[model samples]
Target: MKVIRARSAGFCWGVERAIEIAREYATQGKRPVFTDGPLIHNSQMMERLEAEGIREVGDYLSQTSLEFGLTDAEKQRAVMVVRAHGISPERRGYLKQLGMKFRDATCPDVGSIAGRIKLHARKGYTTVIFGDPKHPEVIGLMGYTEGRGHVISTEKDIDFLPPLEDKICMVSQSTMFTFDFERLAQYLRQRYPGALVFNTICGATRERQSDVLVLAKQGAEAIVVIGGRHSANTVKLAALVEKQKLPCYHVETAAELDLEQLGQYKVIGVTAGASTPGFLIDEACEKLAST
Candidate 1:
């Protein structure tokens, strides 16, 4: 089978920056660098980072309180990093009380969204976020809404909301589909005239989304999406492939690929999420191409 790789497949600038921040502390400071959650969504990369003395300290969602016991000396030597997905202001407060060196590795794009939300919330705007309610990024952004945040993933979610006489602001999680966000924005505007809307999906996410179409146009019979199962952006890529009426094989590693099933396709396309490492993408592509 012929293999076509996406130009914008792996590690986005934000994820790369977050990793670099953690690595610098771990390597240069020679201290254990701990993150509130998985620094990035990819488990393979996290495993590699663990080997380098970077450890995960909190739960996957960044909701639960950190339970590990650290001595005063350990706390003084350790550095706690906020993950790329970010965390709520309340969570931030709790983490800071741990008395460790604190570093925020939140993506700048997410930071921008949080800043906008904080600004409008101070002015008493009801914030409507279009994203998975459980997502760490959405949860973190909600903290900026000052108790006026509502998360909606569907049109029905919007219909169910109570009347809002106050000003309304709408924004999306950084990895949402542009079309879905715009459609919801239009829907929101119809109900709340003069509602403020911001398309805060990062440019890298848009580029990756657009590249899936490019793969389809390049005559790929099927596409392979490589990333962690919990990775929102990677799942979206698989869904996007299915939307194009092509077979999508979503796998964490090349070993997960069903070679017999995939062998039926003459041309296959490959793409990875922002959190995916280049090594994983290369392995998947090489496995598919060699077969």
Candidate 2:
């Protein structure tokens, strides 16, 4: 089978920078490096970081109390890195109170979204975030909205919103589909003509989404999306493939590929989430080419 790999099938700049920050601390050895959550959504990469002495200390969402049996000396030598997905202000404060050095590895793109929300909220605008409310980035952005923030994922979500007398400002989670965000933004404007909509999806995300179409144009019969199951961006890539009317096989690793089923395709297109590492993408492409 012929294999075509996407131009943007690996870690975005933010994830790479976050890993670099943690690894730098891990290598120093003077302090134990820890993250509030999985630094990125890739489980395999997290395992590798674990081997490098970067430990995860908090829950996946960065919620709940963290329990560690550390002495004062240990706490003094510990460093806590915020995940690339970022954390709410409350979570940030809680993590800081743990008595470790706090470093924020939030993607600058996410920070910009938070800044926009914070600015609008201070000006008496009710912020509406188009994202999964449970997503750490969205949860974090919500913290900047003062007390007037609403999370919406669909038109119905917008419909169910209460009548807003305050001015409205809208933004999106960094990983969402561009078209979906635009569609909803239009709907939001129809409902609230004065609403301000900002498309905050990162450039890397747009590149990855565009490459899926590039693969189709290259005559791929099926598309393979490689990333962790819990990776929101990776899941969206697979869904986008299906939206393009192509067969999409979403797998975390090459081992999960159904060779028998995949063999039916003469040419396969491969893409991965922003959180996916290059090694995994290479392995998947190699395995498919071998078949």
Candidate 3:
């Protein structure tokens, strides 16, 4: 079997920087250092970090606990690391209020999006974000609005607003696919001619998605999408591959791929999330090729 890997698979610039920062923090051998969530969306990557003594905090899906800040026993000693997804301005301020050593590992792309959101909010434009309402990046973006904006998770939610009257600014979570954002933005502009739209989808995501299709078109028989299940961008990429009627497995590690499933394909395509590391993709591809 010939294994084909997406050239875009693996760590993005932001993810690489975040991991490097975390490694530096881990080398310090700090106590009870915690990421607000899994620093990235890949469970395999998170396990590797945990094995290195870096602990994970709240569940990435629906976990929002300020316990890291409130634990009296761990208060002054614990080092809290903000994940790459970043946190709300309020959450960051609260984390600081606890008087604990803190490490910020928010991806630069996300920070830039948050800055744009903040800028729009400060300019008196009621912000509207495109993404899951509960997602950390969306939550962080919403925080800049200071309770003045709304989050539209799906296209149907677009119609929920009344006839547009207030100055509105529309931006997206950094990790969302460009197609989805574009479709929604196009519709919103048609519905309300004055809606200000900002495209915040990271360039890496755009390139990765475009390249995944290219790999599939090159006759990849089976596809391996390596990333945490809760990773929106990863899931979307896998879904896109599936739409091409190719067999795709969304997994965090190579162990999850059954020998039988892999054996069924002659050309296996590999892809990953922005937060995924190159080592993980390489391991999976090596296993597939060896089989």
Q: How many residue pairs clash in each candidate?
A: 0, 0, 0
Candidate 1: regions farther than 4 A off: 59-67
Residues 1-291 of candidate 1 have per-residue lDDT tens digits of 899999999999999999999999999549999998888898999999999999987644545567468789988999999988888899898889889999999999999999999999999899999999989899899999999999999999999989896499999999999999999999988888889999999999999999999999999999999999999999999899999999899999999999999999999999999999999999999999988
lDDT of 3 at 218: 88
List model 3 lDDT by residue over 1-291, tens digit each: 788888888888877877777777676566656777778877778888888767877744545675644567666767778877888887888777767788888888889888887887788887878988888888777888856778886767888965556578899988787888899988888777788999988888888899888887888887889887888888888988888898888988888888786898888888988777888888888888899
Instruction: Flag clash pairs in model 3.
Output: none
Candidate 1 lands at a TM-score of 0.96
Better of 1 and 2 by lDDT: 1
At residue 197, candidate 3 shows an lDDT of 96
Which regions in candidate 3 have their CA more than 4 angstroms from the true location? Answer: 28-32, 59-77
Question: What C-alpha lDDT values do all the predictions have?
Answer: 0.92, 0.91, 0.81
**Taking the tens digit of each residue's C-alpha lDDT, what string does model 2 give over 1-291?**
999999999999999989988887889575699898788899999998898899987654545566487888898888899988887788888888988888899988888888899899989999999999888888889999998999999999999999996499999999999999999999999999999999999998999999999999999999999999999999999999999999999999999999999999999999999999999999999999999
